[model samples]
Target: MAENDSFHHVLRGLGPQVEHRGEVIVIGLGRFGSSLGRTLVDMGHEVLGLDLDEQRVAEHSDSLTHVAEVDTTNVKALRQLGVGDATTVVVCIGADVESSVLTTAAVADLEVPNIWAKAMTEPHGRILARVGAHNVVFPEAEMGSRVAHLVTGGLLEYVALDDDFALVEMVAPDAIVGVPLGESNLRADHRVTIVCVKPSESGFTYADRDTVLDPSDIVVVAGHRSDLERFADR
Candidate 1:
Protein backbone atom coordinates (compact mmCIF):
# COMPACT_ATOMS: atom_id res chain seq x y z
CA MET A 1 0.00 0.00 0.00
CA ALA A 2 1.07 3.59 -0.59
CA GLU A 3 2.09 5.86 2.29
CA ASN A 4 -1.11 7.90 2.24
CA ASP A 5 -3.25 4.78 2.04
CA SER A 6 -1.47 3.36 5.06
CA PHE A 7 -2.05 6.65 6.93
CA HIS A 8 -5.79 6.58 6.21
CA HIS A 9 -5.98 2.88 7.13
CA VAL A 10 -4.51 3.61 10.55
CA LEU A 11 -6.91 6.54 11.06
CA ARG A 12 -9.91 4.41 10.07
CA GLY A 13 -8.94 1.73 12.57
CA LEU A 14 -9.40 4.22 15.41
CA GLY A 15 -12.94 4.32 16.78
CA PRO A 16 -14.72 7.43 18.05
CA GLN A 17 -16.22 6.30 21.34
CA VAL A 18 -18.60 8.38 23.44
CA GLU A 19 -17.14 8.91 26.91
CA HIS A 20 -20.08 10.40 28.77
CA ARG A 21 -23.82 9.80 29.25
CA GLY A 22 -25.26 13.09 30.52
CA GLU A 23 -28.05 15.27 29.16
CA VAL A 24 -27.48 18.04 26.58
CA ILE A 25 -28.91 21.50 27.22
CA VAL A 26 -29.77 23.76 24.29
CA ILE A 27 -30.60 27.42 24.86
CA GLY A 28 -32.80 29.21 22.30
CA LEU A 29 -35.63 27.59 20.36
CA GLY A 30 -35.13 29.41 17.11
CA ARG A 31 -34.41 27.78 13.75
CA PHE A 32 -30.76 26.90 14.40
CA GLY A 33 -31.08 25.83 18.03
CA SER A 34 -34.29 23.86 17.52
CA SER A 35 -32.86 21.92 14.60
CA LEU A 36 -29.65 21.18 16.52
CA GLY A 37 -31.56 19.84 19.51
CA ARG A 38 -33.70 17.69 17.30
CA THR A 39 -30.65 16.18 15.65
CA LEU A 40 -29.20 15.31 19.05
CA VAL A 41 -32.48 13.65 20.05
CA ASP A 42 -32.41 11.64 16.83
CA MET A 43 -28.91 10.51 17.84
CA GLY A 44 -30.37 9.05 21.08
CA HIS A 45 -29.03 11.79 23.35
CA GLU A 46 -31.14 13.19 26.19
CA VAL A 47 -31.83 16.81 25.18
CA LEU A 48 -33.29 19.57 27.33
CA GLY A 49 -34.37 22.73 25.53
CA LEU A 50 -34.93 26.20 26.98
CA ASP A 51 -36.63 29.18 25.41
CA LEU A 52 -38.41 32.32 26.61
CA ASP A 53 -41.40 31.63 24.38
CA GLU A 54 -44.05 29.40 25.88
CA GLN A 55 -45.51 28.70 22.46
CA ARG A 56 -42.22 27.37 21.15
CA VAL A 57 -41.77 25.16 24.19
CA ALA A 58 -45.19 23.66 23.66
CA GLU A 59 -44.68 23.21 19.94
CA HIS A 60 -41.43 21.27 20.37
CA SER A 61 -42.39 19.34 23.51
CA ASP A 62 -42.64 16.06 21.69
CA SER A 63 -39.29 16.44 20.00
CA LEU A 64 -37.39 17.24 23.19
CA THR A 65 -36.80 15.17 26.29
CA HIS A 66 -37.77 18.30 28.29
CA VAL A 67 -38.68 21.85 27.38
CA ALA A 68 -38.79 24.97 29.55
CA GLU A 69 -40.12 28.47 28.97
CA VAL A 70 -37.38 30.36 30.78
CA ASP A 71 -35.15 33.33 30.00
CA THR A 72 -31.84 31.60 29.29
CA THR A 73 -29.82 34.68 30.17
CA ASN A 74 -31.15 34.73 33.70
CA VAL A 75 -28.70 32.84 35.85
CA LYS A 76 -31.36 31.74 38.32
CA ALA A 77 -33.60 30.32 35.64
CA LEU A 78 -30.75 28.56 33.86
CA ARG A 79 -29.55 26.93 37.07
CA GLN A 80 -33.08 25.99 38.15
CA LEU A 81 -33.57 24.19 34.84
CA GLY A 82 -30.51 21.99 35.58
CA VAL A 83 -28.38 23.45 32.81
CA GLY A 84 -25.21 23.70 34.90
CA ASP A 85 -24.61 19.97 35.08
CA ALA A 86 -25.51 19.21 31.48
CA THR A 87 -22.93 17.24 29.54
CA THR A 88 -22.96 19.93 26.87
CA VAL A 89 -24.67 23.29 26.36
CA VAL A 90 -25.19 24.98 23.03
CA VAL A 91 -26.14 28.69 22.93
CA CYS A 92 -27.79 29.51 19.60
CA ILE A 93 -29.28 32.95 20.27
CA GLY A 94 -28.31 34.93 17.19
CA ALA A 95 -30.79 37.81 17.27
CA ASP A 96 -29.31 39.32 20.43
CA VAL A 97 -25.56 39.30 20.98
CA GLU A 98 -25.95 40.37 24.62
CA SER A 99 -28.28 37.49 25.36
CA SER A 100 -25.99 35.01 23.62
CA VAL A 101 -22.96 36.22 25.56
CA LEU A 102 -24.81 36.24 28.87
CA THR A 103 -26.13 32.72 28.44
CA THR A 104 -22.76 31.43 27.23
CA ALA A 105 -20.96 32.91 30.23
CA ALA A 106 -23.67 31.60 32.56
CA VAL A 107 -23.12 28.08 31.23
CA ALA A 108 -19.36 28.44 31.70
CA ASP A 109 -19.81 29.75 35.26
CA LEU A 110 -21.97 26.73 35.92
CA GLU A 111 -19.03 24.60 34.75
CA VAL A 112 -20.67 22.90 31.82
CA PRO A 113 -18.14 20.60 30.14
CA ASN A 114 -18.72 21.83 26.59
CA ILE A 115 -20.13 25.20 25.47
CA TRP A 116 -20.88 26.06 21.86
CA ALA A 117 -22.11 29.49 20.81
CA LYS A 118 -23.14 31.36 17.66
CA ALA A 119 -21.67 34.79 17.03
CA MET A 120 -22.93 37.56 14.80
CA THR A 121 -19.60 39.05 13.66
CA GLU A 122 -15.83 38.65 13.76
CA PRO A 123 -15.59 40.66 16.96
CA HIS A 124 -18.46 38.80 18.55
CA GLY A 125 -16.83 35.50 17.55
CA ARG A 126 -13.54 36.53 19.15
CA ILE A 127 -15.27 37.72 22.33
CA LEU A 128 -17.04 34.41 22.70
CA ALA A 129 -13.76 32.56 22.30
CA ARG A 130 -12.01 34.74 24.89
CA VAL A 131 -14.90 34.25 27.31
CA GLY A 132 -14.20 30.50 27.40
CA ALA A 133 -16.65 29.18 24.83
CA HIS A 134 -15.40 25.82 23.56
CA ASN A 135 -16.47 26.74 20.04
CA VAL A 136 -17.79 29.93 18.46
CA VAL A 137 -19.55 29.73 15.10
CA PHE A 138 -20.30 32.42 12.53
CA PRO A 139 -23.16 30.75 10.71
CA GLU A 140 -24.18 33.56 8.36
CA ALA A 141 -20.64 34.41 7.24
CA GLU A 142 -19.76 30.75 6.86
CA MET A 143 -22.82 30.07 4.73
CA GLY A 144 -22.00 33.11 2.64
CA SER A 145 -18.48 31.79 2.01
CA ARG A 146 -19.90 28.45 0.85
CA VAL A 147 -22.34 30.21 -1.43
CA ALA A 148 -19.53 32.26 -2.95
CA HIS A 149 -17.66 29.04 -3.73
CA LEU A 150 -20.74 27.63 -5.47
CA VAL A 151 -21.15 30.78 -7.53
CA THR A 152 -17.61 30.42 -8.80
CA GLY A 153 -18.23 27.32 -10.92
CA GLY A 154 -14.65 26.05 -10.96
CA LEU A 155 -14.47 26.02 -7.17
CA LEU A 156 -15.54 22.75 -5.53
CA GLU A 157 -15.05 23.19 -1.78
CA TYR A 158 -13.23 25.83 0.27
CA VAL A 159 -12.52 25.31 3.95
CA ALA A 160 -11.01 28.18 5.91
CA LEU A 161 -8.17 27.31 8.23
CA ASP A 162 -7.85 30.88 9.49
CA ASP A 163 -8.46 34.42 8.28
CA ASP A 164 -5.79 34.26 5.53
CA PHE A 165 -5.45 30.51 4.90
CA ALA A 166 -7.85 28.05 3.24
CA LEU A 167 -7.89 24.50 2.00
CA VAL A 168 -9.59 24.32 -1.38
CA GLU A 169 -10.67 21.30 -3.36
CA MET A 170 -11.44 21.81 -7.02
CA VAL A 171 -11.59 20.27 -10.48
CA ALA A 172 -8.19 20.98 -12.06
CA PRO A 173 -8.65 23.54 -14.84
CA ASP A 174 -7.44 22.77 -18.43
CA ALA A 175 -4.30 24.84 -17.89
CA ILE A 176 -2.88 22.41 -15.31
CA VAL A 177 -3.81 19.21 -17.16
CA GLY A 178 -1.14 16.47 -17.76
CA VAL A 179 1.15 18.01 -15.07
CA PRO A 180 2.55 15.65 -12.44
CA LEU A 181 2.48 16.52 -8.73
CA GLY A 182 6.31 16.63 -8.54
CA GLU A 183 6.62 19.08 -11.43
CA SER A 184 3.97 21.44 -10.07
CA ASN A 185 5.62 21.40 -6.65
CA LEU A 186 2.37 22.82 -5.28
CA ARG A 187 3.87 22.87 -1.78
CA ALA A 188 7.21 24.41 -2.72
CA ASP A 189 6.01 26.80 -5.41
CA HIS A 190 2.58 27.73 -4.09
CA ARG A 191 2.88 26.70 -0.44
CA VAL A 192 0.00 24.25 -1.05
CA THR A 193 -0.14 20.51 -0.77
CA ILE A 194 -2.23 18.36 -3.09
CA VAL A 195 -3.47 15.91 -0.49
CA CYS A 196 -6.08 14.04 -2.47
CA VAL A 197 -6.42 13.61 -6.23
CA LYS A 198 -9.76 11.91 -6.85
CA PRO A 199 -10.65 10.77 -10.35
CA SER A 200 -14.22 11.24 -11.52
CA GLU A 201 -14.87 7.50 -11.12
CA SER A 202 -12.85 6.58 -8.01
CA GLY A 203 -13.43 7.93 -4.52
CA PHE A 204 -9.90 9.32 -3.88
CA THR A 205 -6.25 8.41 -4.13
CA TYR A 206 -3.62 10.06 -1.96
CA ALA A 207 -1.63 12.26 -4.29
CA ASP A 208 2.13 11.75 -4.62
CA ARG A 209 5.04 13.17 -6.59
CA ASP A 210 4.36 10.82 -9.52
CA THR A 211 0.58 11.38 -9.49
CA VAL A 212 -0.51 12.74 -12.87
CA LEU A 213 -3.33 15.29 -13.14
CA ASP A 214 -6.29 14.39 -15.34
CA PRO A 215 -8.92 16.74 -16.68
CA SER A 216 -11.69 14.89 -14.87
CA ASP A 217 -9.79 14.60 -11.58
CA ILE A 218 -10.68 16.54 -8.47
CA VAL A 219 -7.81 17.80 -6.34
CA VAL A 220 -8.08 18.52 -2.62
CA VAL A 221 -5.35 20.96 -1.65
CA ALA A 222 -4.38 22.74 1.55
CA GLY A 223 -2.67 26.11 1.23
CA HIS A 224 -2.88 29.89 1.45
CA ARG A 225 -5.97 31.76 0.26
CA SER A 226 -4.12 33.68 -2.46
CA ASP A 227 -2.90 30.54 -4.23
CA LEU A 228 -6.30 28.83 -4.23
CA GLU A 229 -8.06 32.04 -5.27
CA ARG A 230 -5.80 32.33 -8.31
CA PHE A 231 -6.08 28.61 -9.15
CA ALA A 232 -9.89 28.66 -9.05
CA ASP A 233 -9.83 31.28 -11.83
CA ARG A 234 -11.30 33.73 -9.41
Candidate 2:
Protein backbone atom coordinates (compact mmCIF):
# COMPACT_ATOMS: atom_id res chain seq x y z
CA MET A 1 0.00 0.00 0.00
CA ALA A 2 1.06 3.59 -0.53
CA GLU A 3 2.70 5.30 2.46
CA ASN A 4 -0.16 7.79 2.92
CA ASP A 5 -2.76 5.04 2.67
CA SER A 6 -0.86 2.96 5.20
CA PHE A 7 -0.79 5.85 7.66
CA HIS A 8 -4.57 6.22 7.39
CA HIS A 9 -5.01 2.51 7.88
CA VAL A 10 -3.25 2.66 11.23
CA LEU A 11 -5.36 5.65 12.31
CA ARG A 12 -8.62 3.91 11.43
CA GLY A 13 -8.97 2.07 14.72
CA LEU A 14 -7.63 4.81 17.00
CA GLY A 15 -11.01 5.86 18.32
CA PRO A 16 -12.10 4.06 21.48
CA GLN A 17 -15.23 1.98 21.21
CA VAL A 18 -18.00 4.03 22.80
CA GLU A 19 -21.77 4.38 22.35
CA HIS A 20 -23.59 7.62 21.68
CA ARG A 21 -24.94 10.86 23.23
CA GLY A 22 -23.97 15.25 23.49
CA GLU A 23 -25.60 18.49 22.53
CA VAL A 24 -22.82 20.71 21.16
CA ILE A 25 -19.22 19.74 21.89
CA VAL A 26 -16.17 21.79 20.92
CA ILE A 27 -12.70 20.31 21.30
CA GLY A 28 -9.60 22.49 21.44
CA LEU A 29 -9.39 25.98 22.93
CA GLY A 30 -7.13 27.83 20.61
CA ARG A 31 -8.11 31.02 18.82
CA PHE A 32 -10.55 29.34 16.45
CA GLY A 33 -12.05 27.11 19.12
CA SER A 34 -12.47 29.97 21.57
CA SER A 35 -14.09 32.17 18.98
CA LEU A 36 -16.41 29.41 17.79
CA GLY A 37 -17.33 28.32 21.30
CA ARG A 38 -18.13 31.87 22.41
CA THR A 39 -20.16 32.46 19.28
CA LEU A 40 -22.18 29.33 19.93
CA VAL A 41 -22.80 30.50 23.46
CA ASP A 42 -23.86 33.90 22.18
CA MET A 43 -26.28 32.12 19.89
CA GLY A 44 -27.87 30.44 22.94
CA HIS A 45 -26.47 26.92 22.54
CA GLU A 46 -24.65 25.26 25.41
CA VAL A 47 -21.13 24.24 24.37
CA LEU A 48 -18.78 21.83 26.12
CA GLY A 49 -15.20 22.75 25.26
CA LEU A 50 -12.46 20.22 25.94
CA ASP A 51 -8.75 20.84 25.78
CA LEU A 52 -5.62 19.25 27.24
CA ASP A 53 -4.28 22.55 28.49
CA GLU A 54 -5.32 23.67 31.93
CA GLN A 55 -4.63 27.37 31.26
CA ARG A 56 -6.82 27.41 28.21
CA VAL A 57 -9.63 25.74 30.07
CA ALA A 58 -9.45 28.37 32.79
CA GLU A 59 -9.23 31.20 30.29
CA HIS A 60 -12.43 30.30 28.47
CA SER A 61 -14.38 29.00 31.44
CA ASP A 62 -16.49 32.13 31.55
CA SER A 63 -17.01 32.36 27.80
CA LEU A 64 -18.51 28.93 27.17
CA THR A 65 -21.10 26.91 29.05
CA HIS A 66 -18.52 24.32 30.12
CA VAL A 67 -14.74 24.16 29.66
CA ALA A 68 -12.58 21.27 30.82
CA GLU A 69 -8.96 20.27 30.65
CA VAL A 70 -9.42 16.74 29.46
CA ASP A 71 -7.16 14.63 27.25
CA THR A 72 -9.32 14.66 24.12
CA THR A 73 -7.26 11.89 22.56
CA ASN A 74 -8.63 9.38 25.07
CA VAL A 75 -12.12 8.08 24.47
CA LYS A 76 -12.64 7.30 28.13
CA ALA A 77 -11.71 10.85 29.16
CA LEU A 78 -14.14 12.27 26.63
CA ARG A 79 -16.95 9.92 27.60
CA GLN A 80 -16.42 10.59 31.27
CA LEU A 81 -16.69 14.29 30.53
CA GLY A 82 -20.01 13.72 28.73
CA VAL A 83 -18.65 14.36 25.24
CA GLY A 84 -20.35 11.21 23.93
CA ASP A 85 -23.72 12.82 24.44
CA ALA A 86 -23.05 15.62 22.03
CA THR A 87 -25.49 15.85 19.14
CA THR A 88 -23.12 18.23 17.38
CA VAL A 89 -19.34 18.24 17.71
CA VAL A 90 -16.84 20.70 16.25
CA VAL A 91 -13.15 19.87 16.51
CA CYS A 92 -11.14 23.06 16.17
CA ILE A 93 -7.68 21.69 16.78
CA GLY A 94 -5.20 23.70 14.75
CA ALA A 95 -1.50 22.92 14.11
CA ASP A 96 -1.53 19.57 15.93
CA VAL A 97 -2.70 17.19 13.22
CA GLU A 98 -2.38 14.06 15.38
CA SER A 99 -4.57 15.25 18.23
CA SER A 100 -7.06 16.71 15.78
CA VAL A 101 -7.45 13.43 13.90
CA LEU A 102 -7.53 11.28 17.02
CA THR A 103 -10.06 13.52 18.77
CA THR A 104 -12.22 13.60 15.67
CA ALA A 105 -12.12 9.83 15.37
CA ALA A 106 -13.12 9.53 18.99
CA VAL A 107 -16.05 11.85 18.44
CA ALA A 108 -17.09 9.88 15.38
CA ASP A 109 -16.85 6.64 17.38
CA LEU A 110 -19.49 8.06 19.65
CA GLU A 111 -21.69 8.40 16.57
CA VAL A 112 -22.37 12.08 17.06
CA PRO A 113 -24.98 13.21 14.55
CA ASN A 114 -23.09 16.29 13.38
CA ILE A 115 -19.30 16.52 13.26
CA TRP A 116 -17.39 19.59 12.10
CA ALA A 117 -13.62 19.69 12.07
CA LYS A 118 -11.06 22.34 11.16
CA ALA A 119 -8.21 21.33 8.89
CA MET A 120 -5.05 23.18 7.97
CA THR A 121 -4.53 21.42 4.65
CA GLU A 122 -6.39 19.23 2.18
CA PRO A 123 -4.72 16.08 3.43
CA HIS A 124 -5.58 16.90 6.99
CA GLY A 125 -9.16 17.61 5.99
CA ARG A 126 -9.36 14.32 4.10
CA ILE A 127 -8.25 12.41 7.15
CA LEU A 128 -10.84 14.21 9.22
CA ALA A 129 -13.63 13.24 6.82
CA ARG A 130 -12.37 9.68 6.55
CA VAL A 131 -12.51 9.49 10.33
CA GLY A 132 -16.22 10.46 10.08
CA ALA A 133 -16.34 14.25 10.33
CA HIS A 134 -19.59 15.39 8.73
CA ASN A 135 -18.16 18.80 7.82
CA VAL A 136 -14.66 20.18 7.45
CA VAL A 137 -13.88 23.89 7.41
CA PHE A 138 -10.71 25.71 6.38
CA PRO A 139 -11.15 28.87 8.37
CA GLU A 140 -7.76 30.40 7.70
CA ALA A 141 -7.80 29.57 4.01
CA GLU A 142 -11.38 30.80 3.51
CA MET A 143 -10.66 34.00 5.41
CA GLY A 144 -7.52 34.57 3.40
CA SER A 145 -9.45 34.24 0.14
CA ARG A 146 -12.15 36.56 1.44
CA VAL A 147 -9.63 39.17 2.50
CA ALA A 148 -7.96 38.96 -0.89
CA HIS A 149 -11.23 39.81 -2.58
CA LEU A 150 -11.87 42.74 -0.22
CA VAL A 151 -8.40 44.17 -0.69
CA THR A 152 -8.54 43.90 -4.49
CA GLY A 153 -11.99 45.38 -4.99
CA GLY A 154 -14.37 48.12 -3.87
CA LEU A 155 -16.63 45.58 -2.16
CA LEU A 156 -17.91 46.54 1.29
CA GLU A 157 -18.66 42.89 1.99
CA TYR A 158 -18.13 39.64 0.09
CA VAL A 159 -19.68 36.27 0.82
CA ALA A 160 -18.83 33.26 -1.26
CA LEU A 161 -21.78 30.96 -1.89
CA ASP A 162 -19.46 28.47 -3.55
CA ASP A 163 -16.27 28.34 -5.59
CA ASP A 164 -17.78 30.22 -8.51
CA PHE A 165 -20.75 32.03 -6.96
CA ALA A 166 -20.55 35.12 -4.70
CA LEU A 167 -22.66 37.77 -3.06
CA VAL A 168 -21.25 41.28 -2.85
CA GLU A 169 -22.15 44.44 -1.02
CA MET A 170 -20.93 47.67 -2.57
CA VAL A 171 -21.77 51.32 -3.12
CA ALA A 172 -23.96 52.21 -6.10
CA PRO A 173 -21.79 52.92 -9.11
CA ASP A 174 -22.28 56.07 -11.15
CA ALA A 175 -23.31 54.05 -14.21
CA ILE A 176 -26.33 52.58 -12.40
CA VAL A 177 -27.41 55.65 -10.44
CA GLY A 178 -30.06 58.25 -11.43
CA VAL A 179 -32.49 55.59 -12.77
CA PRO A 180 -35.05 53.21 -11.36
CA LEU A 181 -33.44 49.77 -10.97
CA GLY A 182 -36.04 48.22 -13.29
CA GLU A 183 -34.95 50.47 -16.17
CA SER A 184 -31.25 50.04 -15.50
CA ASN A 185 -30.89 46.68 -17.28
CA LEU A 186 -28.36 45.61 -14.65
CA ARG A 187 -29.22 41.95 -15.18
CA ALA A 188 -28.58 42.29 -18.88
CA ASP A 189 -25.79 44.86 -18.82
CA HIS A 190 -23.89 43.72 -15.74
CA ARG A 191 -25.05 40.13 -15.60
CA VAL A 192 -25.65 40.40 -11.84
CA THR A 193 -28.74 40.21 -9.67
CA ILE A 194 -29.68 42.88 -7.16
CA VAL A 195 -31.21 40.97 -4.30
CA CYS A 196 -31.40 43.78 -1.78
CA VAL A 197 -30.49 47.45 -1.34
CA LYS A 198 -30.01 49.90 1.50
CA PRO A 199 -30.62 53.54 0.69
CA SER A 200 -28.97 56.39 2.56
CA GLU A 201 -31.98 56.75 4.86
CA SER A 202 -32.94 53.20 5.76
CA GLY A 203 -31.97 49.61 6.56
CA PHE A 204 -31.61 46.93 3.88
CA THR A 205 -34.78 45.76 2.13
CA TYR A 206 -35.61 43.68 -0.91
CA ALA A 207 -34.89 45.68 -4.06
CA ASP A 208 -37.78 46.17 -6.46
CA ARG A 209 -38.31 47.35 -10.03
CA ASP A 210 -39.34 50.79 -8.81
CA THR A 211 -36.30 51.05 -6.53
CA VAL A 212 -34.31 54.09 -7.49
CA LEU A 213 -30.77 54.22 -6.15
CA ASP A 214 -28.52 57.16 -5.42
CA PRO A 215 -24.76 57.21 -5.51
CA SER A 216 -23.23 55.73 -2.31
CA ASP A 217 -26.35 53.65 -1.67
CA ILE A 218 -25.36 50.17 -0.50
CA VAL A 219 -26.42 47.40 -2.84
CA VAL A 220 -26.24 43.67 -2.38
CA VAL A 221 -25.52 41.93 -5.68
CA ALA A 222 -25.27 38.21 -6.31
CA GLY A 223 -23.79 36.42 -9.28
CA HIS A 224 -20.82 34.43 -10.43
CA ARG A 225 -17.55 35.64 -8.94
CA SER A 226 -16.24 36.83 -12.27
CA ASP A 227 -19.41 38.75 -13.07
CA LEU A 228 -19.52 40.41 -9.66
CA GLU A 229 -15.88 41.40 -9.91
CA ARG A 230 -16.46 42.81 -13.40
CA PHE A 231 -19.51 44.76 -12.23
CA ALA A 232 -17.67 46.06 -9.20
CA ASP A 233 -14.87 47.23 -11.49
CA ARG A 234 -17.34 49.39 -13.43
User: lDDT winner among the candidates?
Assistant: 2
TM-score of 1: 0.74
Instruction: Estimate TM-scores for all models.
Output: 0.74, 0.89
lDDT of 1 at 177: 72
Q: What would you estimate as the lDDT of candidate 2?
A: 0.85
| Model 2 regions more than 4 Å off | 1-22
Per-residue lDDT of model 2, residues 14-74, tens digit only: 2334443434788999999999999988988888888999999999989898888998989
Q: What is the lDDT of residue 211 in candidate 1?
A: 83
Worst 10 residues of 1 by lDDT: 9-18
What Cα-based lDDT does every candidate model obtain? 0.77, 0.85
lDDT of 1 by residue, 153-200 (tens): 577787776656777788876655798778875666566677888998
Stretches off by above 4 angstroms in model 1 are 1-21, 38-46, 58-66, 122-134, 149-153
Query: What pairs collide in candidate 1?
Result: none
- Candidate 2 collision pairs: 21-84, 21-85, 21-86, 22-85, 22-86, 22-87, 23-86
